[model samples]
Target: MSAVLELVEFDAEGFMNDAKAWTPEIGEAIAATLGITLTNRHWVVINFARKEFTEKGEAPSLRRITKTTDVDTKEIYQLFPGGPAKVAAKIAGLSKPTGCI
Candidate 1:
């Protein structure tokens, strides 16, 4: 975990325990820990994920992310690599999405 993450409360899986603890800088730190560099495209997904979590009380699924955002499945995979929705939710300081393992 990054120094920034150390300052906040995270679950065993590195998801933030309190979504309010998140900041843009914290998101960057989380991405760095995952070996990702935030791009404009990344921010689009991150923002959408956070907004969805705030309004809906759960992380958005990969399908929802693809449909609502400009990013598609392939691009999301290219951007987030391992598990697009999972990684994006983590960086956005949200719990794992419903369908993610």
Candidate 2:
């Protein structure tokens, strides 16, 4: 299976329980910061981004993410330094990147 797919298979409870890493609080923070309610769509994007990062060891670009999520690229870039990939990665509980992933 693809690395992305594999990453998607990660245990959500374990991820949320990691105090030093992905946590439920962090997810809540991201949702509030983004001014968006956490829904199935958000989960899909988060999981997809995590999968993409795991498969490539890097985040997907804004363009690709926009196409996948149908969210505005400019809006995402305004919210995240690099773009949706960066924001999505964070929401997915991935470490921040030094630059555009």
Which one wins on lDDT? Answer: 1
TM-scores for all candidates: the values are 0.94, 0.50
lDDT of 1 by residue, 1-101 (tens): 67777788888997889888799999999999889999999999999999999999999999999999889999999999998999999999998898745
Q: Which regions of candidate 1 are displaced past 4 Å?
A: none
For all predictions, the C-alpha RMSD in Å is 1.4, 9.6
